[model samples]
Target chain A: MRDIVCEILSNKEVGENIFEMVLLADRVDDIQGGQFVNIQLPNKEMLLRRPFCLCDFDEVNKTFTICYAVVGEGTKVLSGLAVGQQLKATLPLGNGFLLSGKYNKIMLIGGGMGSAVLPAIARRNKDVECVCYLGFANKGKVVLEEKLREVCSKVVVATDDGSYGESGFVTNIAKADLDSLGVDAIFCCGPEVMYRAIKKTFADVNIPIFVSLEQRMGCGIGACLVCNCKIEREGKQGYYRVCKDGPVFELKEVVL
Target chain B: MQRRTSIRVERGGIVSNLKVNIAGVEFKNPIITASGTFGFGREFNNFYPLSDLGGICTKGLTLMPRDGNPAPRIAETKSGIINSVGLQNPGIEHYLATDDKWLAEQDTVVIANIAGASLDDYIAMGEKINESNAQMVELNISCPNVKAGGMAFGVLPASVEQVTRAVKNVCKKPVITKLSPNVSCIADNAKAAQNGGADGISLINTLSAMAVNYKTRKPILFNNNGGLSGACVKPVALKMVWDCYNAVDIPIIGLGGITSYTDVLEFMICGARAVQVGTYNFTEPMGASQIAKDLENYVKEQDMDINDLVGSLILNK
Candidate 1:
């Protein structure tokens, strides 16, 4: 809701082509888990702002963290910034997860860089017992496990190559214990295929499941109708703005 | 050039007069938020006041509510974006019931931009919007005419005149024909709208463009082709606006990739009485308002009335 100049506190590579950056900013008290900040890249060539989810926030330090993968030229430019550099960002954008609901056991699933937002979600819902399932392409791609463990009650990691943690997709691990774990709620963020797989795996469970989506954004705000996703409404399908209506939505509410 | 010693200052000490009159409709300023980019003017109101700009063109409304295209509706190109939103809007009835009151209460002028697949659809929408509180109706001829087998109405002068004349006959409010840039002859299209009794003309609705995902060997946008808009298209838009200006006598509302006050001046110099800020709204939510303020300062610096800049470009032939 406000544009602020954030000073980079630290920027370092946490994994292959992945980075973790902490920024010192003011007025971050309202920023919750699952919400994102649109960071204006310092490069003049790139006009559009990049949206990154809030990996974590420190109210006491007046700082926030964003974990991004260098998938494009914008992030490549972002990776070149030093600790003392400054960047303008629009913060606390889009609706975050509905964390106020009463739940004793929560299952959080993240795939690849999608795992970035899970730490913040776990941190905010400290009252609930949080179990995190993180999937990576391989052991070399794994990240944020220790960060998730700081706030989550349990952190489970999966890799396709079996080089780390368990030898399979995160859905495989979740499928085995999802019903038996007494999970009261579920939240996920990953590729479209992964979301589809998770939705099917937990179809029988009558609990609220939330998923965060990524789309090619224009304004990162709701003004541009570019980042639209189909959702079910009144027994029919309708379109929702991912930037405003959600980057996060109840699994059943979206068609996926 | 001699520097004038006297500086005329308005009530607020800004010498620039931003007010503009187009087709007998008065605007507080010349910066109108482009259609489709501004939505219902409610979303950006969260960042800045709607009253800050001269006008707001509502999202393209159709006869019936449309769900729009499928996922991956947008793709980013060099300094621009391709979008196939397909005029996803609540039908005109929904607008009159929901957004009309809110729009009427605003200090800004409300121009309803409408689209349809046929001439009847255009007339029906125009008639409905004319009965509402909107000050003007912008006929979106850029939309593909499903009845005409997908060819857009704005691509040809004959169809452009046909649709404009039909809608202008039934609509009570001033009609501004929004022309597409995908045509071979933009000037002819502008003249066609004028000949059909359009009160004003808004040009260069997104250029027909495409992008592909090389790995998948498929188009990035679900619709395969989309309209391109942003900084990348500004130069082409400026040229088209100039072309349209020379071809018609009606006031021109130039748009396409307008970002800053300078771009606004460029359009005005090319004979646009007013300009619309489109894709830039996505990058800076308060861009129109910011440009309006900057324009006041710019005119003051030049020691000239804002109107003096309109159609001032001296082409060396």
Candidate 2:
């Protein structure tokens, strides 16, 4: 809702190519799960601000954390900064995962680095029983397993190769265990390919499935119309802005 | 050379002014938020008052709602970014219904930036927006993203004149032709628009560029090549603005890579009556208003008219 300066409380690597940065923000009460912050890097020559999801937050301390992989020039420069550095941050962007508390139990599914986004969902809905399923490329790529366990009642992890936890894709395991999940809703954040697979895997299920999407952005608001995705609303297909309209959407409404 | 002024009282009772007139329309200052970046003045209003800037150019509006291009619409390079949004907008009718009333109430001058795939589309948009409260109309003859009739009219001198004339024939507001930098002679196009009764002109639309990933042997943007904008394009824009300033008699609004107060002064010295902050709006949410504030302080400090800086660049022998 506003752009303010944030000081780095902590910045360190959690897993292969993944970094978790904690910042003391001007305010944290406005943020929610599945929403993101657009950060302006320290270098003034770089004209564009980078968007990162709100991996976690402590509203009492006014601190929020973002987990990012070194994907491009922006993150490379970002990863080099030390703790105590100050940077400009725009907080509480995007329509967050509206976790409906009407159900007794809910499922959170994460693929690869997406595990970072699940813990916040569980935190937002502590009144309800929460379960999680995490998928990673291998053991070296695994992250957030211990973090999720602290919040969710049950946590399941799997690797594509047999290098860690249970073997095989997490989507496959979730599909196989669909009968006993006994949950009312499912929320997932992962690659686009995983969404396609989940749509096919959970085709006949009666439960509601929600998904979070990612895209390159400009303005990190609805203005630039850069980070747009196709979605179906009122039986009409159109491009909706991922930064403002949502980073979270119902799987049935998504055109992917 | 002498400059014009509209003076206001300062805190200590001293007089200072940041106002300038372009084609008979007065702007509070020379800092205007460029089209495609500001989005109808609502988002930036969350950071500061919309009236802080001299004016705001709405997102490029078309006749019908455009789906735009697929994802990966933006790609970043050193000091700049390339975007292929393909003129995504909610259509003129949608804007008139939703954002027009809100923008009219914002207490700032609003300029509608319009684009199209055909002459009829441009004419229809021109007539449709006249009923709205916007004070001016900007003809977008140079969007590199909307590939069809956009580039075809932008690159040619004849087509540029025809598009400007067609819109001028129907629209009641002052029409400012926005020229593209990806053309052979941008000055010729400026002159063509003036000949077609354009009130003023703004330049330069982003340069045609691309970012590639050699490992995948593929371009970064889904639409391969896109229009480039940022600090890297400032020098190129300065040259084009100066060239057009000498070639035509109408006022010029300079843009491309403008990020700060110094950049605004430079653009004014190079012959821009006003400047539009585009790529920098993405970097700083309150940037356009900040530039306006800085420019006001500067003019007050110098105790001179801001208009005196326009076209003041001294040439080398």
Candidate 3:
């Protein structure tokens, strides 16, 4: 990964503390879904590097986008980056979702900020019909609903509070759709509860379901065993690294 | 502000070799970026070639996938940091199937750090890593801030012994058990690991700590508590290393808030054959390699052999 001094082409507020920023990168080759770039925030006072999952990538335009919620000082600084200001990043790191000849139909489920990985997954697998199930707290906190609708065959939105699309969690609506559409596979990136709920819903379904696990990654790459999660297969269980082994895995494989 | 010199200093018409050997296995150098700090050596390669380092201890891998804890997981304190990431990860099979190819190609010792909630969990995960190109298994028995069988197994010397014995039973390669600093007696724990037939031991994982946001009247981290790291915890970690050094004869890999060559020297003097850079990598991108260079220079400047510095400062009580 090359550290390029990127100029913020545009910064748009997507939700609370969440901003979508388009960066002009000279080095944008091999960028894909589930892959993330490490950004070096301004003012060296903030020591650690902040990582944001790639929301979308455009090679012809020499630009890629990142949608992140400013949860800390590092992100707050990134959100304040002006259109002309220079930002540094270690681009195209971590193994992304494998889209190679596996399934015909895929259900992309995202919750809150995890919706960041959806657009890229949809665009790359245009041949496969993508059904999206997005969960939000309320209508006011929703993001990328319209954009997702354009790419996916069917876009299902669910809010905890009955202020939008479906009045329950995205998994409930997804379970209802499974009888008719019967998704061949599932791709998810969201809160733990949402994923856990989805895991139970698809417990009996003999289909491949992948989910992206999140952690406070010290290094966006894998070196530290800091991000460890428990797993079980055929009566045996152990730990897995979210950064290296995943951030993507089949849901059935998860013990959660 | 002046930029720090990242250029490699030359010596004797040769690029200095920083390779390290532990229990017959050769690491390119003694400088291994610790688990949870470097990721899989892939991301660091984006900024700098990962092959330059001696080795990498991958983030902990389990049998099944886990979503980990909620957000607000990390909280930076005065001189250290506290985190409750809750070991978020995809399952081990996924890693072996997907990331193994990329991991094998790297010219570094890929040490798979394995963690589990139970004995069965440890054995299963160790078996998976044994099937891969992973050079060794760094059994992570020191994750102090997590619930659900993680920190509990690490805190007790008996459990440490059991887990080490269990993992060593399944793993084909060397098993280095990473110990928790949160324990009351780290030496006893180290002895427990040694008795359990651990090939080597890595010290001072993380100290249990926390920080509260006064304005919000809540803990800064989402988990309400976290493991502290960075320069601030160096002394505590050093103490643990010193204690473990005196208690056990096994090779010690010292860690916790190592930021400079001075800190590395301190650990070496305390009987660490090698050092793992943890939170320091987050502070400086090339902190580990830079420290390695500094150690080499310091050795040459002091007109001393590299081995001479090992255990040179024991207080013979």
TM-score of chain A of each: 0.97, 0.97, 0.92
User: What's the CA error at residue A116 for candidate 3, in Å?
Assistant: 1.6
Could you give candidate 2's per-residue lDDT for residues B140-226 as a string of tens digits? 987432435335678888888988999999999999999989889999999999999999999999898999999999999999989
Model 1 bad stretches (over 4 Å): B1-15
Which pairs, if any, clash in model 1?
none
Q: Please, what is the whole-model Cα lDDT of each candidate in the order they appear?
A: 0.87, 0.88, 0.77
Worst 10 residues of 1 chain A by lDDT: A40-49
Writing each residue's lDDT as its tens digit, candidate 1 over B1-317 gives: 22122344433344556788998999988999999888898878878888989999999999899888876888878888889987888888999899989988989999999999998899898788877899998989987788999888998999999999999999999999999988889999999999999999998899899999889999999999999899999999899989988888899999988889999999999989999998888777678889988987887777666666677789999
Candidate 2 deviant stretches above 4 angstroms: B4-14, B143-151
For candidate 3 chain B, which ten residues in a row score worst on lDDT?
B1-10
TM-scores, in order shown? 0.95, 0.96, 0.61
DockQ per candidate: 0.63, 0.81, 0.20
The global Cα lDDT (0 to 1) of model 3 is 0.77
lDDT of model 2, residue B301: 93
Which residues of candidate 3, in runs, are more than 4 Å off? Answer: A1-7, A38-48, A72-74, A84-95, A153-169, A174-183, A199-207, B1-79, B82-227, B234-256, B260-276, B282-286, B290-317
Model 1 iRMS (Å) reads: 1.5
